[model samples]
Target: MKAKKTTPQGNKEITDLILDSIADGVFTIDQGMRITTFNKAAEQITGYARREVVGQFCHDIFKADICFKMCPLKHTARTFESIVNMEVNILNRQNQEVPISISTSILKNRKGEVVGAVETFRDLSLIHELRKEISRQYTFQDIVSKSKAVAKLLNILPDVAQSDATVLIRGESGTGKELFATAIHNTSLRKKGPFVAVNCGALPETLLESELFGYKKGAFTDAKRDKPGRFKMAAGGTLFLDEIGDLSKGTQVKLLRVLEQREYEPLGSTSTEKADVRIVAASHQDLSSLVKKGEFREDLFYRLNVMKLEIPPLRDRKEDLPLLVDHFVRKFTEKTGKRIRAVSKRAMKRLLDYDYPGNVRELENVLEHAFVLCKGPEIKTSHLPENLTPSNHRTAPQATGKTSRLPELEKQVIVEALERYGWDRSQAARELGMHRSTLWRKMQRHGIEVP
Candidate 1:
């Protein structure tokens, strides 16, 4: 058999075939930034055909956010450098934003003369969707956590949401009780209806009644017109009463009446309006304890307590710190347009050492503070709040009454995981994203009884 000689045409055809076979979209642009060659993947990703995009301006076809401002091809051309895996957004033919990771390199002639630039981009839409799905597994609406206690609550949320029973949420201040309330409303049949929230503690007794039940025209000195209250606004929807424990006895009686009769009269008005709203009440104070002390109405407490949700404080679910930290970092990075990526080991250690008495809200504030102070890509020890620093606040004491060690924290988390999984190390290891053998070794090291 005679070996056939490869021709220039054959070589060009092979190159085109190879480019078209790749999963990533590939295109080349001339010095003037006009599209020269477009591959099959490029056509599919951008919703533009090869012939249609050929000879057109690259920016017009891509419509990337950085095309006009920070064009990657332009940067490569000027610096004689290459860009690898730069994440960016592009508008397709339908004007929908598509996330893509692009790599750019200079297209040079056989003589090494710069002729054009070539870009390869991979559609990140699927990746983004998968990320969202993974995030959803650990999240409920805006509430994010991976703790067993939270998971147990989340598992029961669907049933709770289906029921129209008044929901009572209990937690410490800044523990995101309102988030849980909102979650209930969002997941409930009243999702499409309005959600009105009122802080009972924020208003005085006189104003509280009018705020909850509204006031008629000329009801009082400030009653210029008939103003609808939170209940009226939340009609056919859900009403979130925050800090309900602070409601005065009089207001409590009125609220209890509405709960029982599903009706209330506006101040200075004889007509009663039907209370059609589903009530979701939240309080940092323990309503049971309040009732025991006669500070809260027992009947009203029982009414609101028909369905209850207890939010664990940050200190109790330290296992969720990493997820929460990442969530906030992304949140603030997008909000502040900072490039901060992650928390430093030292800073994370500092965070892990402290007992967050203020709970999740305080953690968010701490990160926000770090974001403001951090000029670099990562947050450092110096960027943390004063209280989180060693000099300002004493280290959190462990059961031994000394500074808590990372091992102690690890052991606690491991034990919790074991107990959560009914002492099934295999299942607990899977939930912890660790290997079973590794979990067993850790258990042995920590003296955790293996079952």
Candidate 2:
């Protein structure tokens, strides 16, 4: 009934109201790319009156960096159908190179004839300034954080790094344990020495032993030549033992001796070699709990726990999301050679609200995933992973950079489409290019009951 009541005048008023109410600048153009409509937001952003821009060419008004090549609006009008989230720097009326993210959608008539195109652009000048300030504030090697927990840890890291005492870093999987270890090493007295890392869980007990302590020639069947273990290789520097909880009891004894006597021997050699490396160990499993379970050596655990650093998960420090998002967007943009500059308000809202059980690594993966699907300068809601949708759960499989979970993704798209259409199944079906009956059937298949 509501859809039926949307007359031409009613629709125009609704469109005008939306454009005025929204914070992003919006404009429309005819098939010839002549500006047709300029919203209040556009007037404010570009410092131009709607009267002045209505009949002018868009390129003349904005002077976009991509007007000559890879123009998003041109692409949509020429061959492509839509342009969602293309970032471009445009000289405004003041001649300032203001960065803005533009999303374009083609307008069509009842007979599906292309009539015009509408564009929405959000000013990113303030965001850029804020990103610079935050970057200056949170800079610590490769670590970019704005959370109080990390800030406090960063404050003490120099002191922690100065000490030669054994350090134990604890956190969930995907948390940057080795990053902390490397930071400690880079800040320590042995900053110039090699920072060697070995994963105790990645090898069998024999291979791990050989891997930690260099084996003499003929130590094993394929022992071709002498090899220095991570400890010896890291002599005068730091040796990071990752997943130390996975070490066997026999290997634990060897490690405990290395900690106590400050020495270790190769696989086949009899004489003990001096252990000059500083030990920084990390584990996802709680070593204290492992000790209680009798799976870990209490003595070794005590030695490693001399200076413990627990990195909080992403959900605990969500205040860092905006900064982290910006950091990742810039990073991936460089790697992909794309000009993507920002995230849409709706997509960012979903990112802020969701619980990241996978922590910062998962966050990186999400952005990487977005960077792939996003063809424009911004990451839109439709570009995000399906599991990140409000209708999905964190436990759902991450379709990160892959189409492995197509059905789940399809369901989420349908749900989002329905929500966008105010839960009107007919409208949603029309937008999705499917029959209303098909939409209803798919909803039933996905168990999506409308409220």
Candidate 3:
């Protein structure tokens, strides 16, 4: 054989350069599962040199969560199919758990025979950290939920809290509109200042105005001396206006001035006082509808809608029911001095099946009722309120058996897939045509128990 000088411009060298240039870890293994090629990224991410890792079995080089049962690369090689973004945790040389998303495909020779498998994995440590931070940051006070809808709201809530914009929390009655307003205030820059709350619907027109903007001496027959109103009480903080939709037309005009000019006059006072308080208004009714009906002031509606956080009703976030139930159980357990630790399977199923018209508030009340009845470590069906009972037609739970029907079918699919694939989640997910993470979430959501 004649020796010839070859440049790095060759296709093989160019391909190697491209692979090394990328950040994702890339490695190829032979049919015997021995590493054939290890890129620079693979070496960096795994803390293994190319010379050290090459020729070593992948399972030996990188210990992964699925190494024992559901190896994605092995599945890819056996099926000759590519797997994309299978999330798994692996231990690096430092023995620290590193989250990663693996994408794998079988390598074929020129004869179209499967010779080996190639895998590309990206480190998800930063992403996992961000997700954890989001969970910690968005949760304020006792507002806890695992539903993506709530999570999405919370993800942006920190930004909303940091600003001085007026916030309007709209949701169904008992959907915790006021709670959200409180959370906004508690998380805001004015957290150190006082938070004054008032129910606009609770007071009549004459009393409402006087209550909001305090009356001066002899302003009314009962007025004896000058008094500070909610605005004054919440100076440099937040004033939570509950049920602002019920505000009278006259009051709305005054509120508009306070929003526009950032100033308002006290009852019977000619001079205006600068309003330093931030407004966080809440209403179950639609202010936009009120505007269309010529009831709520158009300008006032815009002012209030500057920063709207419309919370989803309880029926929409049923996935969070279990978490809410747990929270309530813990709360009542502490208050009543009971050792209640769990809700029975039947009781939990019933709770999940119910359409919570009153939202999270109603769930709390139901748990309180259950706590009063339950004297054991667990909450059973008997401990549940009569309204939560299946016989109670007013609040039917699983009458049509369609409440958790989707999840039930989904569970069946996962179980069947697992059985068919001999308990290989990687192969099952591939057969089901879903990302491994998506399958995992679905499994968790459906509460599928493996054999």
Candidate 4:
């Protein structure tokens, strides 16, 4: 049987039906820049009816950010080229700024004469919201982690911020102590004020005191002018003193004075200036141990330890490894404009097996090195740093016979106990005759996540 040829009217109806069925907004403009056709999706996205938009000026209806400057449709029409997935913001009838990605193509007649242009645009608001939601899951105030240890600190951070007491943050190097300090400043009542940070360990003994308390003109050979110190610069906000344990004994006396009396004087200056900044200190060394050894001043330690926070090292919080890896992948993707999907399973296992001596900072560097070498969507084990090889993995002492299966048996028992108690870690810990922290640590070691 021969099929009858469809008429022009039937073809026009079919095209209109297809346009209405599309998920993206579709519209066409004439040579005069007037809307010639508007589909159902266009009306839905712009909050305007087809009848109201047809024959109207495209710019007047669309109101896109680039309508007058570098319009995609105009560019396509003039260059005889197509623009695909160019992101732009547009104002809807409700006057809301809606993010959308638009593609444009030149519309031509049968004789190859350019008569108009067609554009297809998709709403990106939902995608942006989803990205924000995903970011919030493993991130708190820009500090990324899913470990219970970090979560516990985050829970009390608001109260700590409100207290305005001197804070001493203890953590290994590269554990993101400054991030916590910044979080405290950002959440405090003085959020609108400035935040100044100085590394006590990074400066020399002579420069450290002058840096913290500034120096008057002609105070020393290098004294140029009267300069404001970190305390002055951070007057209404926070002054983060990093590696406070490195401060010399004499410098510690000055710092203790400032903390106790809230006053200090610049070198070669007679009068004292009132200090108004909140102090947040960090130290990688154990201050208590240093105090016992007479290396760190006991008076200064007592003053700085008012509201203490201890950040756990990356090795102890291995459960956050996957979340941190995914975060770095997303971060580097944006920074390098590469569309990396994920770290491969084998590569992730290699990452999980390693004990990071340098903590989160080392993990970030490892991922960044992988990003530089990776050309594909997934980062493979081969792309990791040479030092991350399987040979460098931490191994337990050699055990023979029944002892070899102890870890496997222990993991199985823990899993069974947690399952039997409805995944209530406390209940399971009690049932297993272990402390909650011990059970939690075991769970992380076994790679168990809450279901």
Candidate 5:
């Protein structure tokens, strides 16, 4: 009888175990590029069975028909060294494009000659999904503010959603005018339709016009093919024109015509296309002022401003500051893999006191900056921007300080802190550096509800 083949000890077993245990997919191919081994993770990622993949050309299985096309294995073979990282699109068994981070190394024999290549990769689908979900959740309803102005806007959103009327959103920059526009689109009857957005300020007149009303083939020097503009692409949907105040007079005339006629002719196209789209225009500058200055057309302003919505700046809605901070903290923590616990009470107070000229966008930026600099769980006053800090311990009150009474200020600060801490009084008190009883007494004095 032939002698029983005995399995080798440590080295081979250790390598196999390590590869199998990794969450990332791992595979090996011979010099001829035929797959030799495939791990379980590889099976999960590519939706291919090991029995089916082994012995097949790696390019065939990966659908990389063009061998020179960003193939990590080819790089490894030429360098005889590991290609540590690269992002590439791979086709799965379903022929879906899958984004993956690939790392590859050339396997060599004792003679220092390359024999084959081994590759490891991680599927990016889960990470991409998580990021999308987090961004959607945080960036949408996460805008913080408790001013009656904002509350009134929120209350009116459902009604606005029910209408197909043109919406003109007005706000200072960084006050989340875009967020409101998105909310309107998402809640509208055309929610299922595409919500195409463009920043009018980002493009010059010619480009902006071309972007809004796509050009036909050979319309311009670089026009190689016909293109559908944002208006056409967003048919039966919503088109968000951010920074609408920046639009040139000529563009305004074209937009006004589209709004009135619900049809437009593409550049260099004789045929007019019917555009069934809802217009949501936003501007940091006052359209009325622009119209008065003759920089903006009165007819266009009236056409676009069928239903108006205004977003208050952050400082005006001090009651919403804490909630906004918490929302941002959770969002940043998830994004950066940090363990930030809370923002300090003193810090919250300072934040409430400051005038946020940059508005909510600025506030988010500050929090993001703080998250980067923060070493501990709690974000303290030191983590905040320098401008937010009080300039002097003792200073005379402003001439108009009487407009904001001390009691009202205290009430607003307490309410903001509570909201920021998700209504947790203990956390709020701890942040305020005051006893719970003291805070309760103050709340009672101000006739503020605890929750």
Candidate 6:
């Protein structure tokens, strides 16, 4: 610099500095396809030093016989001026293929004659990491519920994580039963194993059976190939069966056998395979009463009810509403790339006062809708659904005075408690000065939601 050096060394230094500053890897290849320039990022990406890569054939560096096999490189080079974007797998020093997105442009001399090509590529590893992190941070635990009932459930989670016991989760729809199931699976010793879930009520009895137990090839009209059932796929893992109360009697018998024998035979297959899965069944229906009514199997009910966990509804967990709102605000902000900061107090009070029949799921949906509709940073009553807004009109209870019996009153109280605390039964039971299990029993006897 003191002598204002004009040698090739000065030009090469400037080029290296420019390439090193770029986040993406950069490489240059001459007309003969030999790598002439390899940037620092390129070295990091390929796990090869610049000295080792320079002067090597570009195809050899990428472990490809020809770079233009599926690429537009040849066309771009012939045209002498064009930019192309493509997804390609490039081999590293260890010969492992890594996915990358490459952007290539032709390099030309000062007289406009094509000389070589410059390619910039970004590694896909960072994208995969960001996706995984986003998924982990959004599910279940992020759902806030401050009711002591929910806290108790959270406290027991660690214990549940240590066991492979069959768990039955009873709750109303939208009470976060699936979230509890996922949390238990993720926290358990079998976290690395598959976590398969099915909604029993969503499918027909025939489809549900086949879905759970899988079928051998030619087992049915559409069974072209043998399929691994959820039970088989979830081996050494956890299977979450939602709406278990809706399972038909025949399916119940099969499930009971799987539970008792720890093995099942696929449809149209003679050989029996052992199942190494932990069952976590949930329902929004009263299974005990259904059993007594001869609708559900008593033996199966007893087997599943061994370690029962009840999730409280949103109304029962009113204290957690604010926390949930805040969490959702941040979540939707990042999701939509909006700047939403808070929910209005008056709107929040209305939300707390309302009886959320749909439970936590409904609350989340409400927030999501509000986030989309809100015009400012703060969410307000105007952003909420019409049905949730306070109105002068009221609907009479379906039950008449003649039907206002003890069971009816109990059911009403339980439902109201569920609504008040956002469906948190533990807090509701504490408010009633009775044990959670006792409350569950009463709810069952009164025919209230207790899946």
Global lDDT of each model?
0.86, 0.85, 0.83, 0.86, 0.81, 0.79
Per-residue lDDT value at 374 in model 5: 95
Candidate 2 lDDT over residue span 198-237, tens digit each: 8887678988998898899898889899988888999999
Question: How well is each residue in 337-390 modelled by candidate 5, as lDDT tens digits?
Answer: 989989999888887776654567667777887898899999998988654544
Candidate 1: pairs in clash? none
Error of 4 at 398 (Å): 7.6
What lDDT, from 0 to 1, does candidate 5 have?
A: 0.81
Off by over 4 Å in 2: 1-136, 390-451
lDDT of 1 at 339: 99
In model 3, the worst 10-residue window by lDDT is: 387-396
Question: lDDT score of model 6?
Answer: 0.79
lDDT of 4 by residue, 1-451 (tens): 9997999999989999999999999999998889999999889899999999999999999898999999888888889899999999999999998999999999988999889999999999999899878655556688888788898899889899988999999997678888899999999988999999998876788888888898899888888889878888899999999888878898998899999899999998999999999899998888999999999999889999999999999889988888899888999999999889988999999999877655777788788888999999999999987556442332344444554554665687679879988999987765554446556757888898999
What would the per-residue lDDT of candidate 1 be over residues 1-451, giving only the tens digit for each residue? 9888889999888988999999999999999999999999999999999899989999999999999999999999889799999999999989999999999999999999999999999999999999987665467888788888998998898889879899999887678887888888898999999999998876789888888899999989888999999999999899999889889999999999999999999999999999999999998778999999999988899999998899887788888888899999999999999999989998998988767655787688789888989999999999987656431244244357556576766677678768887998777665444445446656777888865
TM-score comparison, 1 vs 2, better candidate: 1
What is the RMSD of candidate 6?
A: 15.4
TM-score of each model, paired residue for residue: 0.60, 0.60, 0.58, 0.59, 0.56, 0.58
Best by TM-score: 1
Segments in model 3 whose C-alpha atoms lie over 4 Å from true places: 1-138, 390-451
Per-residue accuracy of model 3 over 224-281 as CA lDDT, tens digit each: 9998888888899999998899899999999999999998889988888989998999
Q: Taking the tens digit of each residue's C-alpha lDDT, what string does model 6 give over 1-451?
A: 3787568898889989999999899999888878899999998898999999889888778863336574445556776555645767788889887777788889988999878888888888777678666533223354455567887788788798678898999987768788889989998999999999987866788888889999999988899999989999999899999889978889999999999999999998999999999999998778999988999999999999978898887777677776777777788899998888887888897777666655666677788888879989888999987657331122244455566354554467678767777779987664443335556657777777743
- RMSD of candidates 1 onward, in order: 12.8, 16.4, 17.0, 13.5, 17.9, 15.4
lDDT of 5 at 233: 92
Worst 10 residues of 5 by lDDT: 387-396
